[model samples]
Target chain A: MTPAPGDPAPAPGLIPRDSLLPNLEFPFRDLNSRVTPTECFYVRNHFPTPALTAGGWSLTVGGAVLHPLRLGLEELRSLPSRTVTATMECAGNGRTFLSPRPRGVPWELGAVGTARWTGVPLSAVLERAGLPEVVAAWEVVLEGADRGVMTEPVPSPGEISYARSVPLAKALDDVLLAHEMNGEALTPDHGFPVRAVVPGWYGMASVKWLTAVRVVPGPFLGYFQTVDYAYWEEKDGLPPQLRPIGPLQLKAAIARPAPREVVPCGVTYEVTGAAWSGEADVARVEVSVDGGCTWADAEFLDPPMPHVWRRWRFRWQTPEGPGSRTLLARATDTRGRTQPTCHDPARGSYMITHPLPIEVDVRESSP
Target chain B: MTPAPGDPAPAPGLIPRDSLLPNLEFPFRDLNSRVTPTECFYVRNHFPTPALTAGGWSLTVGGAVLHPLRLGLEELRSLPSRTVTATMECAGNGRTFLSPRPRGVPWELGAVGTARWTGVPLSAVLERAGLPEVVAAWEVVLEGADRGVMTEPVPSPGEISYARSVPLAKALDDVLLAHEMNGEALTPDHGFPVRAVVPGWYGMASVKWLTAVRVVPGPFLGYFQTVDYAYWEEKDGLPPQLRPIGPLQLKAAIARPAPREVVPCGVTYEVTGAAWSGEADVARVEVSVDGGCTWADAEFLDPPMPHVWRRWRFRWQTPEGPGSRTLLARATDTRGRTQPTCHDPARGSYMITHPLPIEVDVRESSP
Candidate 1:
């Protein structure tokens, strides 16, 4: 069905994991390029898309600031802008693989995509707002225009705006108030008008439908910040403390020879996939055919880039005999972090960066 | 000070993590051969080294068997023997890295060593004991001759033998009762006369100073099995369940260019380490120089083998600038399991297989 005006027109093959909140997953099997097309990029929304226009929208910056500033879309564009090629991944991208199934959107392996974001750095807006009170500021909370009553994790008091907070240091670093995705205006599903694009962090930190930025002196205890998108920080002899999830864990996902795909025996097949991390560039990607018993490095299609996924491919000579084989890919980030084989329960359903197994069948001939 | 008669004469340079229990660590920096020499192998003893001779020692196999047998060392040696080159690592090998420091042996990265073990397979002994009762058998308990009063985790009523249980499937697979290590008689510190060698499992399961083997119809609840060597098995929405630690997790350790050691800048330096896993072969090893920011595959010196560690080396051209740099290595197992970067608290003090960071100073010249 064709989407209505202002509605998200997902790419033809984009798989909708949920319909109401519009959580779409990109078809990774079709992944062949580094930058994902706008329509083909996965869409993750905490609430129904808000019908908003650039002419009426203005980002309000206040709280812990000497000067409160309201900058309209035109004013934001007039300011010096920067474009960053980054990969944004939903925190719960691989939630479907969590045992006992976590209580959240069940994403598989496609809730991640890369794009070129153009916008004024949040630091510029914060600077214009004046930060004489910054000495006491601990975090800058970004509030989205989209609002909804939270159900799971905990019931919120009436309808609340979708919001999250980032540490003051991160806000002034590479955070962007992006109005353009790729080389064009942001689409409705992709946070139209303007959105906060937080590089090297989970997508939740980059709140969509940007509205207000509040710099607070203390930690933000919002529902999304505490009840959801948080992990248990376990210490010896101490109770597991809850901490908000942040950076993306190093991860790799196999794209080609899709799960259970039957391929002809005794032929070389090009296995392709993407590897990414939150804080570090993916240094190496390895492919394993015998269920991880042995691994060979996959050639990177693109040079190492900050805040973006690297495409990698490995050529696998299909076994002479027809049988079932499990294909797996694992990535190690420059910071020496490697994808784990087992899901960490401390992370609950988020940061599913474990090496996922893809079982494929080798047949005498393609079935 | 020289050790007296029947005392453990450790090899020169073996560092003692604990003096009383004689938990010695092999100097990994001196690791240069595939088979670690007898005196150089790390020694782990719970109680005083037992002084026993082969003529006086016997292995008693009982419980849930049609034929309970007591085979002396001579009889055991008369049976068909197999020599396996395997790596035995203490479960708490890297406990020193755990934050807040869990109670146990404070080991660094030296509680592991490889050796050629010559022994009679435990499966052969179990078969001679007759397995008609195997239908109800659940686990095989291996008890050591050494006994000590337990104080940590929980207090024991009196001195008790060090005993641990292995699943029936694993006990019947590759478990060995070895009387020889590196083609020589087992040393007093290395479980004199005889010992159980549970390949592919943590060294704890091997039960040094072996005395008895008991097959039980249910899980064994020995002090070591349940209290000391257990981890919390975390499942969603459930209280963390306590489960005994089992097979070794995939791990790699940087053995050369020792931590904090200074090397001359602007020259080729060989980064060497060893990687191993419990159930699969070490498939790949990658070395990271920039605190894990980027990685290059290390060349494996040894061919892939079952139940053994693979030594790997990567030649790195030292940067011209003199500064402190962190070196790290990560390994992936054949089963697609890669070493985790962070320690999981759920594992407590056991399975410390995360990539350990080795900070080395690149100086103008060697001091």
Candidate 2:
């Protein structure tokens, strides 16, 4: 669907921009959004879109399995389960926000989305596979039911298993085998049926459309798991350091109905967006109508939860008289982690978690 | 094909050690290389691969034109063209080599590749389209036959097309709308039939599976062109710089076998590799046999051409005695640019070009 007039399409339609193209297109915006809408969710697809059907689907447990068995959706549902609301942001969400110019995907703002996931603990599936009763690192491979699966392992060291391993600890967290989202069955677009919910890790580790689970020793070095998300750093003659899966970093985004929306003369408005972190719960989310010179506490929609997003909203009365106005949103996660004031927009590695400043086209009120 | 047992796989195979998975998969080399075979080339699909039949495919030129024209493969073949054996590095090629950890598409070393891209001069196509008569500053957009086409009025102020644009001047260079590769019809994997060969620019500017050309005003920010390959630095302490067509920075790769090759004792060997630069030609490529202590000028293949790779070969006289040896290759491009020593694995903004120190496994030959 085409967006009317000069409006950027919300999630489900927003495609991160690529920098290398010859011409510039689109009127892009970086919404320091409070709540990332579904349609506006940023997407990062590795291969061709796999057309999966739920009717004949089953989650299979393989690899070091004593009894490799395929459990139908019904069977998976029969297993003990739980539910949790969490947010998942692509590591490259705010990539374009980086400086020194990070490589790979050129994300303008950040691509983040929150949803309620329902699934069984990854440990449950692995247990059914039977323990190897051995000592060593076995990577938990998650294979998607797609044609690309054939050539998948060919690309990575492990035969293309759509898998990522969690240490024996994280996999057993009463983490749900999410099948329902926000009280609705998982939509095909959002990995229907089941997907892993390994809280505190980057979204990539929470494999969408989770299928099989295995207990691999050592590290989960699936191409996407180990190879892709890893980062190697060499600053000033120091040895390079590689960052594997760790808790999410603190970040905030401001999103609203208005793109410089002109509020009626003297009309009041609300400043809102989302704040989250894999590190810790958010303590407070703040908004600055005066470009961060002053901060106002934005009410959190709900008490913060671990690895879950905290929605913050602040209501403000537009100045009785106005020419134009601009506002910003910033949040402070629980661990004394405040939302960044400005996205670094680094070019070399793609991490640009900048606070957003937006222009508001305010109209003067007539008496 | 699987590599021989004793021989290491091009990339992520086990490193014949007690450990199964190596600490790091893609080892850093001064020259960027994909460890996998051609089949394992990291597929950076900006858009779905365009499916064009070689039987009878034509390119359509429209949008701001005297008359919409369709040129068949034959017509494009009939046009005068040129070909160059250049290396196309994704502007984001070295993301795996970054620090402070940026975000976005997690691309490995494979994002860079060397191919004999063939194409007709885009300027010739514009002539056939009758430019000057059509539009000015009027950018041209290239749309692929693939369903994924950028929305109209490219997101950029330039209003370029879904494909990147070539300034009117550069488009007219001896650019090729190549029909053959290494003297063979284009392979589908290599954009068979037709594609642009934008010299000195990042791979994104050279749209694959060329189909539609729409000339308009402004930069063409298509999904492939703009949304995915850009870098922005809007941070507090930063200087403004003109964005160029993302060009491949100076890069070099070891062409000779890695240092790990087992060499019979007391045997002299040759150290070799290739170097390239996008902005300028390579001036000098040096080889350091003694681990960067002493340097020697490696022989550079002659008539160094822009957009073409220059091969450098250095003959090394192995010590007559017996012991494991270390071999190294360092290349400098034409612009007096020298390869940086491997100080840190994650080097620059996606351009991790550095001097390589190859390790050789030596076995003494007994009398």
Candidate 3:
């Protein structure tokens, strides 16, 4: 498996050796799968997987600070923490759908997951790290423990700690020093024992196996978040930047017909799937049996959970009319966002919802 | 852990000896956090962990007609599978929220999780198993390869295979013979190789390390699903029929701030956690700082996958006021079904949405 055309380019030498772009599997196609199993879960490396130890991990906060300090994991953990329900999306999510195909891993739609992140707020940690002088744009430079003396140049530089900054305001959004995911300790690949879990943002912001976060006077520019994953593009021949492709956009899918679906009609069927958004609660999901002309709301099971996908269902009794028919499902979130038609399923790798189609056979209905 | 009133009672002699309940760093507050880490994941056992050689593992699904089957792992993998997002609630999710603490493990709260399930559809497997005569009610019993034999007399008499069945309907409702979770292979404990994943239901419906599924006639009256986890609760003060709590109810919680909360004023703090339901999608989660008077819709992070819990947040600028403020969160589904303010968290030890309380300081805002 190689990088899907739409996927983000590999961070400076981040692609592993002998690693053919692994063909990713779409999560939630089966009802008994791990929502985001370790392996298949998307990997968005800033530089490369840094080798580090928990016993020696320490984060430093500097700049215009009253007192700059390096707090050990033990010390960091000793501070108060805020748990958050956040969904981390890779900036390159759904990238494999890019037109002409982007040069990246062909992610088969399995690059996202929602988790209960537990960690000290970035503000508290930064405050504890001491906010150096009052600058226009505060840049928090994160440095990892991995052996990286100077892989790139300065100003527009690259370091080990995979550092990036928030808009001061967004940076203070109670980010967590996430020590856990779901309810288990962070697995090694996902930044064992620790990672930054920022809510409502892209995965790049949530650095893994993090260490030092130094405050600078200007915007932090690194190769990972800025150069590779982030992009500007236009829709339908419009001007660029109208729909910036930096972070996660709203999306949904039919989990029932996942991977592949086949059925004999005239039988009762419950069409179901999931829907989500960056800032929207899924309001409804519509399914169409005859293309996109007619739509119906699927019965949603249980109340919606924040940071989790909303499951919806629609019961259909196929008529014993004729041959095969395509069933299409589209979801809409509370922000009045509906799944877009598959304008071009292969065009944009991420964001736009690709109409999920299920092919079924028509049979005689039971009396 | 002993089976309390609300907890699902495993078979007699099923409780483990070294079953000292492990202490969690955080208190039981949210529906998702109730999930135990690998070490703490609740194990509802009917028999002890089995002993078998992978060398001899074989599954046979053939009876009356056409394509009778006996397939090994390799043979099964040759077939395609569908994936789905579903929540597996312990039939006794709210058992721990019972009155005077029920007679079980005294589970702190309803423990549940949502994951992406992958496997061949049960309908396909049944298609291979060949459709036997359709009975009135129907029973599609599934059993594991583990050791254990029920001594109870067969109530139905015509027991075709050691299996249970639902209305030939449920079997067609996207049941899966899942081999993967999220995107990785299933863990041995959860159910390796293969298992049945029934969406919109409790954990028991999913038979692990599945051995066989015989479509018998009539309803399933297995000890674990029916006699043990199911209950008769006084709904509106009436003890209805001793029916199994089929679907889940609205539930929400604050991951932290349990027992009590003590914090300095003006320090921007975050109140977050998970919420879920078995019956409908949670529409809105309202948090109250002044007990139950003032309600504010907290920020919720919707999951990219469906039927999972959404992580939610409510950021408040600590007021210049001072007093003991209790923090409580509740949920409502698309059907306008909001979690009740009921103090008792358990509904028949199965579904509980009891309001959780927390005390916080309202010191002046940080300078």
Candidate 4:
């Protein structure tokens, strides 16, 4: 049987998914608190999470380092910690909107969220381990404790530790080795013992339950890096550029005045939502009550915080006409990147940053 | 930071728990179908579930068999399969109600549910494997693929596989090696590759992610079998009787008219609930609205089915005077086993089969 368009009935706190596998997304409309609750944070596990006890688990840093280091939970905690409020978004955040609908988790707009991550910076750990100065091209590979095999991009399948690598510059940047999320120890779904938190990159780069960090001389060849998360740039007669997805694209989504919700025709209603970008700060957000035909700037509820999303709201007086109205939102980051009116099918499911149009029905006030 | 007592906000379809270590319970009040939905079927994982791929996974049946068999998923599926609708209740179902508060998952009344399981019966598998008919003290030891060192029951600190066993007679009697639950392939939370479904026994006896089945001479002594699930009958100054806990107890619980829920005085309310027993069928159920001072026979909505629960209801007419009231329910099985009013303190967390008292307030109705 074909899976329903989306998860028919998702667990609470999550938006439904196309795949029944545990690709859970947080319902961002319920984002009421400053820090997203651990239970409400989006969970994107490639495999079932392995349980690790504090006493028996340790993080090992080796390969291309002057000093190979193995640090237990307490030992890692003893290092100076820094906290950063970062917003993480999946590369396939709006995959359901992709035409020909990709054969993976078809997520909607709820796959993006923000949380206060507390941990030692990867740079700090690398400094203690003593990184060797090298002129050759190098990539820092990260291996999560979760081990499983993938059946996708088939024909050349093999078992792999859930592993990925980043360029040496990103690895030495503000990337964090996070052990705590939202002021609490990470839950099993979020990687309990420790996880890598790449501040501005898409979530898959933030490997959870991180156990190993190895510096390899050359570009990484992991399936997640070379195939799955890569985008195809199909063009006219030229070879498709298989570009691995990195930073998130500018995006905005309506969280309030939900789809198909009934509203009083003559009453003024407040439409609220969130806007975010990967590396750049959100400069402005626009709301369109006429399905992108016309747009109006939304008032920001909070000032822009560097790696975090900002909430924006717009008040609209309902039209006298009693019918359905389409609401749309688009965001522009400081880099002048704005959402597209529609998605590019050739790009497949990665970075689907098209503006979402929500429909709300207007009804006569009972009073 | 200390974890809160019960999830401040539980996911849809799951009942709250004292410990947040994924001790999910079914919301029995919403029990609406013939078989419990997989999402609502109550998850009880002592350790994190490990992901297993179908390609590299096999169930090995060795020891005391003329032919030691290692069957892959397809090979296992090729055999004759049977479907059984069985009710599974955790051994520590009502642990929260224990006087001295047990040291594990503090579950309340929601830790029991029924699901339709499909798989090959252990009897048929044993028969096909050519079990030797010999007169010896033999036990069938089952081990799950999940490996984790446990710290419990004191003193014995060593690495042991998650394993348990049963007497040869019980092992070969209608035991099912299930690969599916509720007509669908088991979810990872419920054991993905395969699991054992032992009817008439507690949920722990139905080990999940089963990997090995060894028929060994003499009783099998594993940590889960000899220590964790065992009861301690501590008598004053005397050695304790370390008896293994098994089978479901005669239990009844009020599903509707939840504790602390307000109801209009003088209104007729329908009180609904479910009751079940292992081995013996439920014979009768009694409900009391005045704290057990008086009792009334609850009307059975469905007739008692073997190994499945029966739904029951009662018409409760609220008194004209507005005040708080307590509701209670009890059950008796065909074996003449009745639920105790209180638990055995020395038993320590397993099988607390006492009638639950729910408190509710009465208020005036709105016109």
Which candidate comes out best when scored by lDDT?
1
Per-candidate Cα lDDT values, in order, are 0.81, 0.56, 0.56, 0.76
Off by over 4 Å in 1: A1-11, A133-137, B1-367
Residues B11-57 of candidate 2: C-alpha lDDT, one tens digit per residue: 54212211321112222222333122333223344444556887668
Give candidate 3's error at residue B260 in angstroms. Answer: 84
TM of each candidate vs. truth: 0.49, 0.44, 0.41, 0.48
Return the DockQ of model 4.
0.01
TM-score of 4: 0.48
- Residue B196 in model 1: lDDT: 89
lDDT of 4 by residue, B75-172 (tens): 88889999999999998877766666757777777788889999998887777777988534677877787766555543123334566777778888
lDDT of 4 at A231: 58
Tens digit of lDDT per residue, candidate 3, span B1-367? 1111111222221123225322121123322332233333445544445544455656666433256677787667668888887766665544444566644444454345666788888787787777866644555666676545432211111221122234457776667888887777776666667878877667767777777665644334443433234543322211122244455666676654443445446545666667777657777888887788888898776642345566676775555466677888888777887766664322334555677665665445344
Better of 1 and 2 by TM-score: 1
- Candidate 1, residues A136-171, lDDT tens digits: the string is 337888989998876665444456777788989899
* Fnat of candidates, each listed: 0.00, 0.00, 0.00, 0.00
Q: What clash count does candidate 3 reach?
A: 84
Per-residue error at A199 for model 4, in Å?
0.5
Interface RMSD of each: 17.7, 19.0, 29.8, 26.5
